[model samples]
Target: MGVSVARTTVATKTGEVGGTLTNGLRVTLGIPYAAPPFGAARFREPQPAAPWDGVRDGTRFGPVAPQSAELPGAPAWRPGDEDVLTLNVWAPADAPGPLPVLFFLHGGAYTFGSSAQPDHDGAALARAGLVVVSCNYRVGFEGFGHVPGFPDNRGLLDQIAALEWVREHITAFGGDPAQVTLAGQSAGAGAVVCLMSSRRAAGLFRRAIVHSVPDATFSPDLAAGLARLVAEAAGVAPTAEGLLSASPQALVEASDRVVARYAADPDSGPLHYDTVIYGPVLDGALLTADPLDALAAGAGRGVDLLACHTTEEYRLMHQVGTMPPATTEEDLARFAAHWELPADLVDRYRTLMPGAPVLDVYLALAGDGFFAAHTARLAGAHARAGGRTRLSRFDRRRTRPDGTPVRAWHAADTPFALGTLDAAGVDFLTGGPADADDHALSRRMIRAWAAFATGGDPGWEPLDGATGAPVHVWAVPADRQEGPAPAHALWHDVRAVLRL
Candidate 1:
């Protein structure tokens, strides 16, 4: 496949940009949404990019935020690359007027990943009659770690700035800013819901599509404690002045060490299992409460909501050797007690999944407790608060010819939803080559996303003030609208049972 410069030039507030014509879309990459968040601006709010006199080349992606992650097909962070707050755009080359926009945020446990991931290609969605956009924000210590006398949740603030840029400049790229649908998965999904509750992000997007929302917010005290640990590992003071003296790489390495220490300690509490130390901090100004609590109190009632989670979200973590296994009764009991789960939770799971081994049961409980149940509860709370909300679950599963079972786990739904199942390196996520039926399912999911972005129903009923009832299940062969699972009742009071 060959690529050439686009004939059209889009003018933004900062400058004009020239992109490339690929397939049937005008694809632009590396448009700065905010200035470099380092040096004099380190740990402060994002600033506007300096205007350029001529058209800036938008042919390549910008640098990823300072982190240690090296995602396949995505640009990795390197020292001396200061420009990380950039965005990408994709619009149909021949589309006539302004189209609805689908703004996406990439997820990596709020620590890593970038919009430049191959699986995040928005060309398919652009061809589906929408302008697609994705951006990179701060992550890891630079984004979420606490510094004395500085703001928290700077990564989320960067997202808000990106949305502001979209609101002001998307029309030049053939997108209607007022018709934006903010979407994300995992940590990105968590950011979506957090923004929903943030008054600062109010009115920026008309709708939201969140998948696999994680319950990983930190109190001020916890965030401060984590920062102290990272600072100690880096041999720097925990204050803003001292932290600013440390290089981003040093902090990244230090954070990794802290995570390793937690993973090795059996009594390190919840961090021992997940090992992800960064997330949105509960600051009373930007984020006043938990997203679940905020949604229940009608924080984002004005925006439409669509939520989803895979049936076996945590299975991928265990299979990939990232999460520690709870194979024994003692391990399960310790996990339950550490996370403060209700005493009856494991017993309940045993009754629900009779004859299953301890590991399988533990995976089910951990997956639901961490992601699936929270996603369902978010939809329910949004609906009950008088917001237009819809819920779905991904249950696509198959066994390969070599007898490798492909359960719908973790990020398996992304390629399908984004129409990127055939993209490079997607086989690992989709469990190998997709068959014809898998392609058909991908088309259906893509169509559903386009429909929902256009403010229409996604070929299913929306949740109408019901708690986890009537969900659209995405699968091959046929999709179905079904009631909640037998275990849904136990998660109704998730805050009480799954306290992190």
Candidate 2:
């Protein structure tokens, strides 16, 4: 088919080409910058497309990189067979002067998610007087598999290509390419951290905000094992040929089953580690090391960092309609076997969160393991590395009518953060005004994100240069601030008890 030039400027994010939206804001989606992975391209590092002729159809969102959640034999990966590295953009109409570019990475444990989710509504954010762009890259086996002859982390390369796209073409959309800020939640948050830590990612973005990052780093051996198992399950040769011959449906199905295997373990579920289907790999190339390890060693290359989490980070997972019991002794044993975290941590977590059911303890342990403690450690490390960093905690917790405390769950900040508390897109975790505290706190956080993306300080107390006690309580009314610990931790001295 012939590529036609259109009114909007069609471009690539990283290496994927995207089309533009013809609405109020000059929006763009699904332009390809990389070759499709359907054939020999599978299991190899991403390769740039040789550029297209004519103005491509710079409009509409494209199919995601094959997700197993969509059901077997479904056309999960569609929208033409080529061009998987694409980005969507929303810029003000008749815009004047230089606008800042906000780049977003979608969250799905590095497995399932698309930048086109309505909740991430870039129109509102763009309407707030900024140029917003969301993007897609490879996920699962296609993105993370560690082929014997090829390097891993092809997905991250896709992100780099997208950022490069912003740097090269965002100016055409009325944005200042030099003033780009990378923003994402969950797996996307982990992507932000990866970009910051990568030496290859130097000068790609000026700022970053990561929400509830799920430890994206993995040992090469672990990644290899995951690839081998999944590749074999699909009846493929576990080599480049095997992957190329396997259909996206087969690959996605294998990935979903693997995710199911790890669903019982809360930490494993969020990290996408249980299935080992696909994720960032520490393969000695593209990625040099894990974020925690890299940051401590002063290897983040000095990207300004802003990190935060909801009051109750994991409650959303439980509220999920399909959520399973991610917390059981079986999970702990698996965790112990994997991380070598002394099998006692399973029982220890229970003691710390007394009076709660298995799910609560499961939630707490998963939260701490995935985000809470990491936030603390990352802030201190960034400070020690002489980089600008700030921290915040969403202190909005509500007692449900059922008398169950949902607190600030994983994505509780979205409705509040996007200023769409009653927006129609997400009716699962919440409906109506967030508990009184959430509404007030949401304003603080939303503004905080806007301000931090524009300036270094988030209008809150800077993290301690010494004591490391500077987790800003981001809630309504400055007089009452609280961090990530349980609401009644001081009353029962939860930390002290856990030490036992």
Candidate 3:
């Protein structure tokens, strides 16, 4: 789609911004939500964007946050800049008044991702009669690295800043600030859950859609140990000044080395035999407690929530060769012991899968431990807290070019929900051309998401009790399903035991 030079301008509290009209939608890209977190500002809370003196051009995307060049099945890094605290907007050109806003946060494991990625285009969603916005925040060492004398979770603070910007400026672009729906996938979903528990972001958004939220949180001691390892890799002290002296890429490389070492020997680290080291930290100030505990205490009391996970979320990790294709019973038992899970859990999983392959059993156990378990717990907590909550499972399956079957994996619902199945740069996730059934499923997802953003039911009942209707399943032929309650029950106890 070629963008026509139909100049459109909107006035924000800071100043005016000029955008372009394309395909019946007005898009304003790279609007700064906060000042560049570089130099002395690194590792600190996000500061307000400096006001511009003239109408700023919003025609192209801003540089993404500096991150590692390595990613699974993605192109090489494009050398992003430190001044990357920016956002983009897509609003219907013909909407006369304030429309519901769908604010999105991209995901890359709190490590590598950018809003400028082609897969996150918001034009289709905008054309569906809603205003869509996407923002970029720090990731990896630059965002989550632990250092003395610096605040933790600065990346999350950057997101909070973007939400504040939306509350103060989205109205000028035909979006209702009060009707904002915060949505994300993977690491982004984790951020949304974190924000839901933050007092600073209490009324910033009225609704939330969390897709494939992984169970990862860094305890203070574990985070401190990881910080030391990163600093050792960089040949510097674990302080803000010591880290600032090194180049951003060097810091990223050092962080990667630390992660690899930890993954190789989970028993040697202060992480209690856990491999993954980066994510939201449990800082007492910004994040008082675990998100589940916060939700149970009514932190997200009034926010309508839609939390979902793919039926096979961990398949992507296995398919990309990052993880082994299969695991032994001994390895599974070790993992269960690491998480303090019961010894009989592996037997129970085998019973659940009856004659399944070792890989299938491993995927089931890993998926539940990492993604499904947390998602189910979050949904149940929200619903029990008197908050309107909906749970879903994405069962859409596809085949790879090599004839390998790829089930609905992590991030499979993004393009479908955004109505961008045909968009560029998503072939790896969606595989071959989408069939008729895929298109139909995409339409249903878009419609349901839009309906939920408008504060209406998404053609399903909210989660009542464990015995109520199963989660609204999204598949080639969409339908309501059951039988996940038992798995959820199992995980509920597991998470409680692990205090996750």
Candidate 4:
């Protein structure tokens, strides 16, 4: 893990780029994969990168896409530029041959995340013996805003461009492009699902790892209506020309206001306010059909798949205050009704977890509806389509520095999988100071992930449709356990009733 202060350079198709070798890992940051999406290029498909002459320094991170400064516990708003189509790469400094690659996408509900987040550092994963990559794409109005005369889902197009770049240039950085695996969390996982169905993204990778894929897709009508709301907030017309005239900061603020309004009064619009406002649109050209529908039709026929969710994915929403804490029986009933859930759903949950706190009950229902159910369905579909699929449920709980308990909430497995439990913000999501047990769990997860990237088994059996081993549970004391638990069956039934 010794740091090599000397600069290292690699020749990519666009040009020679400089990087740094730190602790046995070479990291190249902020290499643009496409032309800047500014002015005329806004809301359009990503274009090829402008070739450079001399070696360009790629050691520093680039500015993220224009976005609101409203994330909880984040620092003061730092305005980013429109020219933010960049990516970062981490690979072993002295690998004898090109290693397998893992291309990751960051999740911010499709609106508010950047690859530059400290927790997303790929060095640890690279040290574990793979070429790890992360990229930044447009978000919010600049990425998903549906104005007239503009192509839809431009963010996804940016991702496709980055993947294509990897295909062309990763070998120079000691990565085997043919053995690539695409992995993501939350909205990023949703993007992976979308890409699995995208004709544009076919054969970009050989394997997929999707975590906590939320139910967030907007119909064209819903996207258009949301665009009008964003336009009105920015004091502009809903047309591309009118939106293009506004400042990037204005657009960010306008998108933030629209999100806030949706949070405050979720029922005010045709869209379901409970879901993310900005996400991949079911535009026929980019995304031919719903991801599930596409998967059912064997869209990702040859790809290996690993899909999973935490035991309590909804706690993150409650922790962030987007959803209220459920307390009374009346509160449970209200939540059920709000989501148009069947009346008997609450009683079913009560039966499933007798004497459980109302908050826990509510979390169970919401978690299944939002994450677990869809992920399970996606796994089943992939398995049915003759693809190798593995499923898991993370159940590790920890105490924060302040002694507050953090359950297996959304994203709790991220630090473990990345082998970055000591990183900042991990303590908040996964409690304080990871113990020996935590480190052991992290090693197991990292090993499994890296093994999967290497086209090897992850020390667990693939999900079996006939024998009913639907999920592998990851927890303390016991690293892995096969199960077709009653709770999972109950959740499947609940999701069926709610059509989630």
Model 4 vs. true fold: TM: 0.93
> Which regions in candidate 3 have their CA more than 4 angstroms from the true location?
1-5, 70-80, 265-275, 399-403, 483-485, 496-500
* Top TM-score prediction, candidate number: 1
Better of 2 and 3 by TM-score: 3
Predicted structure 3: lDDT: 0.81
What lDDT would each prediction earn against the true structure?
Answer: 0.90, 0.66, 0.81, 0.82
> In terms of TM-score, which candidate is stronger, 2 or 4?
4
How would you encode candidate 4's per-residue C-alpha lDDT over 8-28 as one tens digit per residue?
Answer: 898898999999978777889
Task: Using lDDT, rank the candidates from best to worst.
Answer: 1, 4, 3, 2
Over 4 Å off in model 2, which ranges? 1-24, 70-81, 261-276, 321-339, 343-354, 420-425, 431-443, 476-480, 483-500
TM-scores for candidates 1 onward, in order: 0.98, 0.83, 0.93, 0.93
What's the TM for model 3? 0.93
Model 4: lDDT equals: 0.82
**Candidate 1 similarity to native, TM-score:** 0.98
Q: List the residue pairs that clash in candidate 1.
A: none
Question: Ten-residue segment with the worst summed lDDT in candidate 2?
Answer: 491-500
